[model samples]
Target: MARPNSSPKASISPQKKNSSSPREADFDIQQELSRLQEVIYESFHIPVSRWTIIDEDKVLEQLEFIGTKIPEAIRKALQVLEQKQEILANAEAYAQRIIQQAQEEAAEILDESGIIQQAQHEANQIRQQVQSECEAIQAQTMAEIEQQRQMANGEVEQIYRKSVSEAQQIQEGADEYADAVLTRLEQELGEMLGVVRNGRQQLYNHSAQRQTNNSGKQLSEG
Candidate 1:
């Protein structure tokens, strides 16, 4: 027996439904860079006489990963910018078409031989109406373009600020960690020095006692 036909909707892939939208796919490159910075900061060890130690290979690996992601983010942003430009271009083209059509209609009305005054008045009215419509369209288009531009700028600024804040936090955490490590190291070194000094004092006393005993034996023998 022949099987029934499947619906068109049923043939759609599930992956497409789960995929992220264009706006959602636009990632913050600065944030990713900041995360890389944080990782590097966290990996660093306390400075030893002006030299801080870290895993160079691991840091390089993290930087490479970030490098791979940056281009993708930049591409997404460029795509968004292109989309905005296309929208503006389309709007301007539509406005031009409307204005051209209005002008043609007005010219046709003015070309009529009989009822010249009526034709002239009607043409003037048409011109006024088309001018107002053109102005309105231009204003609306400009508004939309400005709004989109502001939104894009705001998004970029927000990303930059967030990255800066994250970087600052990473720096603070690393500084605190280094300070703690250094403090512990200093305490340990101080204890070691104290132990060495005590050992030297003990050795000096023992040597002096031995010298005095030898001197007493020599005097008694004489």
Candidate 2:
């Protein structure tokens, strides 16, 4: 003989039967709520602000599903809600902490930016001061070098002029000495010429007298 059709309850899976049990009804409520909170936390936050953007429709869907499952659960949601004030207080404290931390971080970043700008400004001032000092030193060095060069040139010119004057004086003295020696030699040569002329005239006179005497003697004897 053919078997009769079984009831739907008899066809239910063991997993389905366990899910309706008192241990973990359908799913863990805390776990689901945690997932929801995680979803909200993962939302996009605005920069420099604690504002977050969430998906309204998706969040509502998850909440509605969680609410539907609450009645099926054996007062688990009631137990969770029984600590509402404590949960809200903890949430408020957590939000305040996050806001305070964000504000402190923003202030730190602003302070760092200010410090960097201040450092740059001081660096520029130091650079300008160093450049000015270097320029002044260079100008002073150039002036000192120019003054030394002028002094050296003046000394060299003075030495050259003194040497030229000394040389001229020596040349004039040598010319005067040479003229005096030449005058003395001319006088000595003229005196020797006069002595030689006088000796020749005396010899000529003596020879004439001797010849005349000889002629007279010859006549007297004849």
Q: Pick the candidate with the highest TM-score.
A: 1
Badly placed stretches (over 4 Å) of model 1 are: 1-26, 44-48, 107-222
- lDDT (10s digit) by residue, model 1, range 1-222: 122222222322222122344423644544445544554444534443333455667667757766565545544544443343344344445544544554464345434333334434543554455446445645664564455446554465444334444435534543454354345434543553454456557767999999999999999999
Task: Return model 1's CA RMSD, one decimal.
Answer: 43.3
For model 2 the local lDDT of residue 180 reads 42
Among residues 3 or more apart in sequence or in different chains, the pairs in candidate 1 whose N, CA or C atoms overlap within 3 Å are: none
lDDT of 1 at 169: 52
State each model's CA lDDT, in order: 0.48, 0.46
Cα lDDT of model 2 by residue, 97-196, tens digit:
4434534543443342333343334334433543454355345534533543354444433333243343345345434533443344335324433433
Q: TM-score per candidate, in order?
A: 0.36, 0.26
